[model samples]
Target: MIKKLKLIDSKFNIENKVGMLTFCRNDIRNALTGSCIINDIINTVEYINKNNTVSVLIITGEGKVFSSGGNIKEMLKKNTSFSGPVEEVEKKYRYGIQQIPLYMEKIEIPTIAAINGPAVGAGFDLACMCDFRIMSNNAFLAESFIDLGIIPGDGGAFFLQRLIGYQKAAELTLTGRKVSASEALELGLILKKVDPNQLLQEAKKFANEIAKKPKNTIRYTKRLLKMGAKLPLKEFLDFCALLQGISHNHKEHKSALKNIKRKM
Candidate 1:
């Protein structure tokens, strides 16, 4: 079922194997408007989670940029000056935009962000939502929230600090600097960078490899990581101990144990 969210034009391309969800408006570098697209992302992800068919999701951009962040012009038109504009957009952003990343954060299936080009602002937050990221060499990540005289929303502070480390994430967010693909990979902000022409191919290859892993194990691992930020270490250890026991009894674990015995 093509979940209806207007800003996104779903192709249903590559179907159950992997869903290639791209931003449809490339004219403005596929920037997200504060409307249906964000809701669409939430709807699409939830739909995928319920469907047994879609094993992985590959999210990419349209023409040049992944997303130029949230719609700046829309925000500007709402309020011409300082804190007023911030409050005007903030309510819409929090309600309409944040859910996309939140859904992504809790998603069971592995998500691959194919950074076809530069991603800034909320776009950067969107990229950070993915389980793995494969970027184009031309792709850059910008923390533009500060430049706009606003703090990073759409999960900027939450994900960046985790990705690169507190001090580094602080510097980037505080400075509103644009980090290159090479620098991002080096800092552990991203997994790898591919040439622009090869970006999608690399993402698919990575997704396919993940798709081959035992599904429940992957889901459990992702769940644990999601809990990482929220749980105390002792509690986390207890949770993992229980989860690992469940995993051990799973058939894939049993099969792997059998294979190991045969090798011995």
Candidate 2:
């Protein structure tokens, strides 16, 4: 078992192959900055990637907020994370908080974000980075960088457009409004919205269902999905055919087919 993390609580269930990570910085609504927690997130993702027993990762926040995104106070004071000159600030962003999205993009394990409360600004972008999102009915989300007189610095513009399409992404990012859970569902931003009390339970249940599938198949399927997002139709279809051939030869696929035949 891996040791518990400081800024994040990591729980792994070996029997079910599920890993849950809770962001514990409720003091500032889990606000993010160009701080050590960026490394913490990268390290956690790397740890989960290396653990073969863990096929899924669940991310949530403690208390009433998932994350407030960037530390606005720091920006206002031009201190702590935002004190440097323009060139220095650019480097800081490149080497610090930027690593989270870059590292998270590589994890092959299925990642789910269980949004327990308000996810604003970069916080909402973090959730978008995950493969899936499950929100508490009481939770809300906002691409609120515009409200702060800034832009989506952490890939919100790109990620949100991919998730919900360009027009809607434009509306949210441009308006910088808080979107309620029901509106999020209507926009196809989340998979499900359950009661706050049932958020983690429902997310874990879904993770377990996915984890029960053959691990290699899940990984390959996830890869294909990522590829499908980036590749042209013809190129994606070619890659899909090749991956399907490999999947057909997998022992897990063979066993599943055999069971189906036996039942028939």
Candidate 3:
């Protein structure tokens, strides 16, 4: 059975084996640092990983902004996550907002970012963490941390470079420029762009497509893809062979074979 998640700053629902998490703190523009969004995200990812019934996850914001990243007001006041000494700040980061990326990386299911509006700083990094990004044509993304005299304290550099290569990632990071959705598609940063009204529908459609696949195979394939990025070719193939053996022995594999034979 799939477990119900108690998210403090977000809303979650499941349908057709696809779980959707919407950032609900539009009052603060879904800022990660000041609000409970980081905890919500980490918790949601953890829940999805353990829930075998869920095959894909779609994340988006509820209002005009996807996420404004950190709360600038809190930063100026040196309150909340931005408060305290250098050591204190480091500890906050290590245990607080930084947990999102760590948990996201370990998720076994496929993830999609439905960028409903501007995704700035850590917000952009959040989208980059997903396996796929479907953005609204009216929305934009920015690596705006440079403007604040800070860097991506949430592992943005690591994911961005892998998504769009180092040169493009460096240009965006150093310049802190806003990238339109169309431009993001051209740069290979986002998979597709749709009208604002169609963003969630399109994202759900994409999610459902992946969700329709054989359950265990989807998780295993996602794991293999992540391993492929860093594992040596021989090691990857060895792992793949092991998974293939397990997959072939599963009942789903037999059912799939029977279906194929019937069609033939």
- Best model per TM-score: 3
Better-scoring candidate (lDDT), 1 or 3: 3
- lDDT against the true structure, per candidate, is 0.79, 0.84, 0.93
Q: For residues 1-264, could you state the per-residue lDDT of candidate 1 as single tens digits?
A: 755333354334554367778877676667766334565677777777776456788988778889887777666674431225556756766666677777887678888889998899888888888888889999899988998887876778888888888999899988989899999989988889889999888888878887777777877887888787789999999999999999988998998888899999
TM-score list, all predictions = 0.85, 0.90, 0.97
Candidate 1 lDDT for residue 210: 74
Task: Evaluate model 1: give its lDDT.
Answer: 0.79
> Which one wins by lDDT: 2 or 3?
3
Model 2 local distance difference test score? 0.84
Q: Can you tell me which runs of candidate 1 are displaced by over 4 Å?
A: 1-7, 10-12, 79-90, 254-264
lDDT assessment of candidate 3: 0.93
What's the ranking of the predictions by TM-score, best on top? 3, 2, 1
Using alpha carbons, what is the TM-score of model 1? 0.85
Ranking according to lDDT, highest score first: 3, 2, 1
lDDT by residue (1-264, candidate 3, tens digit) is 666799999999999999999999999998887888998988888888788888999999989999999999989884578889999999999999889899999999999999999999999999999999999999999999999999999999999999999999999999999999989999999999999999999999999988999999999999999999989999999999999999999998999999999999
